[model samples]
Target chain A: MKNPFKFKKEIVNADLFNNDLPLPHSEEYPDEEVIFSVKDFQFYYDNGEKHALKDINLEIFKKKVTAFIGPSGCGKSTLLRCFNRMNDLIDGNKKEGEILYKGTPIDTLNTIQLRSKVGMVFQQPNPFPMSIYNNITYGPKCQGLRNKKSLDKIVYDSLNDVGLYEEVKDQISHSGTSLSGGQQQRLCIARCIAMSPDIILMDEPTSALDPIATLKIEELIRKLKEKYTIIIVTHNMQQAARISDYTAFFML
Target chain B: MEKKNKKINLSYLIERNIKNRKYKDGITNGSTFLFSLLCVVILFLVIGYVLFTGANYLTPGFITSNYSQSSVALRTPKDFVYNENDYDFSDLERFDDTYYSEKWGIGLQYGKDNNQNQVIYLVQMSENSPFHELVRRDDGTNFNIPSDMYLSYITVQTELGTYKTAFSEDGIENMISTLDEAVSIYDSNFLTLGGGISTSLITTCYLILFTLIFSLPLGIGGAIYLGYYAKDNRITRIIRSLVDMSSGIPSIIFGLVGATIFIPFVGSMTGTTGGNIFTGALTMTLILLPTIVKTVEESIKTIPKSMISASLALGASNTETIFKIVLPNSIDGILNAAILGIGRTIGESAALVFALGTFITAAPSFTSGNTTLAVHIWYILAGEYPAYEQACAISIIIFCVVVVLSLSTKLINYLFRRKRER
Candidate 1:
């Protein structure tokens, strides 16, 4: 069998940095693979009167759990939104830089297509006002998948992936909003994974949950990296060190 | 002594302030409560008066029969007395009165006038008695006689006997025979005194159906555009304000517009000279548009923006989002709009009178001039002798229909909300 957490050894004994330091020039991995490369990225708000992100350069590895940890107003969430152009929805916000996804410019890809490939889960448990089963199947149905047998398999697989199938198996038809805050957050994660995206962007997915629920989500994140490349923005430094293969600290 | 006196004065002032505030509150609250109670009482009194006056006349016959007035006089020959028994009065012998009148015998005949029309008269057998005329000219011109005329019945008069006569247009026999003949006749004028509102009811139903069909889609579509699609800008603000202002315009103004615009437009298509139900429905569509649009737009605006964002994030198109999420969630508003439209259509008299003329037809067609229930009531009241009884009956029917409609709409809204909650 192959070890899924092979990159854990690189960051286990690493020292936490206190300030914005330049990238190290050491060659740790000779065969390292990069999934996303941000080059000279700059983000502006209020039609360029305010600078939200300035000259950001980062590289995310394939099939690895990468976390962005920073204090409030450090633009961690803003940078995560740029991965799939979710920032385009905001009015009068501007971006000037190239964000490459798998060696292809993200700007070249269609927004709907990019979102389908790189799904997102929000901080708040914003589950749709619908049943659990319907919430899991919403993405597939939007892509025009009509076969019932396949949809049922996808719903079961997605729910089981997030360890929610056991607790909500009998009540899959109940409203998604009826679940507890922790369960709702997991359901949102399950909803994001149901689209079978290559990369999953989670913006503080477990901040609204209890300690036990947070621990469970961290464990799920450690396991999910075997199949998906994960990028998470978190305010908790301990959580960033526990589950992430690589951590980037942003300064305000 | 000074400190004690100050404490007493402070306590007294506080007490007076509380008492004055309570008294003011009581006055305002009591007046508002009394005003609301007065409104309820007035509503009940009006409904009670309508029910009391119209309940007796709202029979099945009144609802089904047509409007008509006919003049027919039938009399029997028992009223006459005669001295002679040997008389050639075989034509009148078959009547019911001939067997009972033993002392009198009657002779009946028809004569031809100058215009070759048959006129009926009676001959008495008693000596020195003048000829009795059953149907005669007011000029008293007796023409030549026709011996082979049809003798249906006869009439006779006597000195000290009561006569048997029948003078009615809506008698039992006449109603059945008229209804039977009405099936074949298309344009027969109603000649009976007692009439019904069957035509007006049918016209009203047609008007309601067409008005709803034409107005709902347009109104709802406009609402969707204004609520979801239009950007918040100067043009949109102006448009919304215009819609709000149009709702306050009097219905009489709409009547004039309908008369000038809709009637002529429909006349060109249906080839009608003046007004019809189609024209009325078209005019009603315009009148109902602003109300439905405003209400449905407001309801759509009340929906949480998160729901819209959720749908959009799922890659659903704007049109799909509107059809699936926004419209389904706002079902209560759509139903409310429909109910209000129905109420307006039912109570609208002035607009329909201009778009659909007030002439009542027994069998009204789509292109025919007709009257609705409100217009019928108006016509009844506008007559020289106001038929308040019939007006009250129609008003009662309208009231019941509007109440039932409003109740059902509320029931539908409740069920929808419950389903959504589940």
Candidate 2:
């Protein structure tokens, strides 16, 4: 007779407490204000159904990196989507609490205007099937900027800021998808930035990437938080601990 | 005792092997292979049969000329006296005297005299060819004239002094000569820009244009409503079911409906009674709309919800997201639907039969009567004389055109997909 199950080896936790900071670090700028406030928010897929998120209250400050760390299906991504009303696309999806961006109700605001102000990067890199130049210029063009010079400048500035400029600047006609996975992910971030949105939400942005690319994106997030309000969802605890100023832990 | 234990162990091992193997092994049955082979065989048979029939009728002259009845019928004098008894020198002088000219000297004549004393002449114009001109001699003898018998005398000279013969006795030969005549006549009479082909071409193009005009936007709009705006309720389910079922209904029924609905409405509104391009287009649109809607709806459904989410998160309205992002991304799918709709419209026969009648006339205006390729094929098939081989040739032409269209559509789709991926 053979044993029903075999032992699958588990590697011990390496790099433990590597990026964790000592508790109670002082704020870099104490004068800055909180831009987003969520109060006792609960998300439900149906009436009296399984609660995806339960009585969660949180704040996202301007020019700060706030991260959510959780296991699979723990509703961390769901809470992130609340800031931009991304949950509205799901049928029968309801929320029980309030989300405020700059003291105004998120639900009552025009969805289009709110989305323009709050941009998001998905876990999977989804660059439009167009030229690298077009990918960066998509949002700006959608906002009705038609001048070639203006578009060129926006493409240049956005790519430069994302550190992908030298690799792609000369190959303007190349496809956006032709880039390396790390570059495509960075291009998505650049696309979010090119919109000039005040808030940027990232949903496990580097989960699909290799280690070196993941490190680059983690570092880039810290630099991005200097100007834009940032909230990132990550399954990797060390990533949340590395760049996030405030970490929210969640469990399913 | 040892032998008994070994036998039990062997039985147990056999049962274990049977249990471990699942039912879905990868072997294919004979029936499936036979059925697949049958389909291929049937397709080849149809193609071979059509080609065989069509080749029997097609000749170079048949393809290029117009029809003339005078080419085949026997010529007889309106008034001539008949001799009752003689076979040889009886009508030979009369035959030569009446038909032979200085250029057409000594035309060959042969055939037996009938009891009525009428001479049936079989005219042998060329020595080795089946092309012979038949002339009726008064004594019932038939004469064969050389193919050049008539053309030899029909000479015209230019200033350069070169004689040009305008008429020939052996009208283009092989298989079905009358159809060859019809093909030539159709081309010469209709296909020229100011003639038949141009008029029919413009009518078809206009019909296609109006069909797109009436069906595309409405179909796409309906698709968007069903795919995006309509809640997944009983009403939507019923609407979807109805559209799906309508596609299964025969096209002829739609033709009948169109004939009853559009012909009278347009006829009353415009104060005219008869066929027109506009009426045909309306009929085609009704036939095409359901197909377009179903195709476009399937395409819209393939768009990921996250794309819409991303757009909405940026504060784009449903309409804005749909128009700006969804539609642009799904352009290939929309184009596929449109091409298929056009192909369906072009090939549809039964619907056009009732909506646009069988008369092959040059349409001068939207209100004028016209016939399309499929309608012409139908008329050729069902005509009083029943031109079978000609109909087969025309069908082959239509089949070739459709094959080319479908192939180009596939090629365009491939290119668009490659460009989109890039």
Candidate 3:
């Protein structure tokens, strides 16, 4: 007798994968106000010899969390990096496109200044190997704040906004690394907030976290959308649907 | 048939197999132990030999002298009266009078003090005749002769008592000079090799300052370019190869380069025939550059690429990112490199020998010849009379300085690593 519980595994056919799909519109929705506009964007690796991103037109709206969901090797991460010109660091990587930030061409803008304006949180909770206080104040200090009071105020306010202030107030001077996974990610969010940027980019922020921490981050993202224009990249479809106001689905 | 054969052979096979395995293991283990023991023994023997030969020259006087006196004994006719003003035998005492050998410049004379102290004078050699044994005669006459030749000790008159002083082949004059100089200067002070105490202190400080000035920025820049700015390609590969080659280049070659390039350039600028402190510093910079570059590059490479990205994303320019995020984060590594560079510069001898000549005097000038502590040891060892004792003392001095610098750098780096970990 055959077991009723046994199921056959289905093989995904490679030929059925689409080379082209409906390109996302460059215009924002009726209620949406465009924060970033990507016009005819194309990215290539190996000095433009290998195309990573095809001609893509899209609009990212302000003060709402947008999630980029895709399978592995789908160019989702690469597309996210283009917003802040983070791709410049990878040698032999080139892009032919216009990524606009608040109606200003991102390519023409000062890269450093542009990065400051568009803050980023990485997949790994990369809290600098320094004290929590320093991690929070690093961006502000770079922008040239000399007063201790101002720095302290910024740190507390940013930490409070990320909902980490109460838990870490007594140990703000302790290393950011000396925290739980969820707390470290929250601290990273606080650090980004301390910079007071117009937009925040996150790449798989909850991928390395457990279910409980992932839920906490998803909630935090929902709250964060009130103040910042947040873009998140996640392989977890449930997390995108739960936290993001607008979702861009991608496949390879 | 198969079952019967298997059952009978089990015990016999097991015992035989165990015995063979044990024998093989014993041979392998024995050979490994022997090789380790041999290596340790050779290493210990080499260290022991170096210490034994090196420390043999150290004497009480060698520890104190500057080793500046001429190596050869200058002789003249007996009619030429020895100057009394140039002699100092303050530490010696005589208790009795006896007939001393005066013919060979060997004898003793003593003068009594109110404290019941007596000053004893045996045959005393001049600054130019450190190796010459001076024997005093019983009648108060003395003879000075070269130490290689036979000389007889003479009985001398003293207020306390007469005692015979041993004829020593080692000259104590350089030891005296060192004491006199050390009393007035710091042991690490390199600024004044020939000058009295104060000048040597100043000279060492100047040398350190000049070396830091010449090496720090250029080294850091080179490291930054290689570690961060330069794209990894053929050009960078060649530059890296050149840097590695430079680090391995013999200091003597650097010295020649320093002498040929820096010495002439500074000499021309100052209208001097010989290079001064400035030229010496320029020479040392080339010698120390590789150390600083390699150390700093290693340190800067330790920084996380993500941190650099975070900084750049925060609107910091490349320069700002380097100065703000990269440098601050890497200060410990940079400091470690600096300490190593300083130590390398200080211990360097042959290179500076040609670049900064080993002429030391009571008062050193920027335009005049100067000697570093290492160069001083070299000259002391190379002299005709070879004041090996003074060289030993100077080596001890260099060793102490290098140890302190290296230890502090290690400590700082360790602390930083711990802090980063925490």
Write the residue-wise lDDT of candidate 1 on B298-346 in tens digits. Answer: 8799777756655665556577679767897787888889888999899
Off by over 4 Å in 3: A1-28, A147-149, B1-65, B69-209, B363-365, B402-410
Model 2, runs deviating above 4 Å: A1-32, B1-28, B56-205, B363-365, B416-422
Can you write out model 1's per-residue Cα lDDT over A7-61, one digit (the tens) per residue? 3221111111111223233234435567678989999987788899999999887
- The prediction achieving the highest DockQ against the true structure is 3
Worst 10 residues of 3 chain A by lDDT: A14-23
Residue range A150-186, candidate 2, lDDT tens digits: 8888888888878999888778888888999999999
| Candidate 3, B-chain TM | 0.61
Question: Candidate 2, which CAPRI tier?
Answer: acceptable
Per model, state how many residue pairs clash.
5, 39, 42
Poorest stretch of ten by lDDT in candidate 3 chain B: B183-192
Error of 3 at B42 (Å): 4.8
DockQ for model 1?
Answer: 0.21
Rank all candidate structures by their lDDT, best first, as comma-separated numbers. 1, 3, 2
Q: Write the per-residue lDDT of candidate 2 for residues B43-145, one digit (tens) a residue.
A: 9898888888866554433333222212222322323222323113222344443332212222333221111112223242223221222243334344544
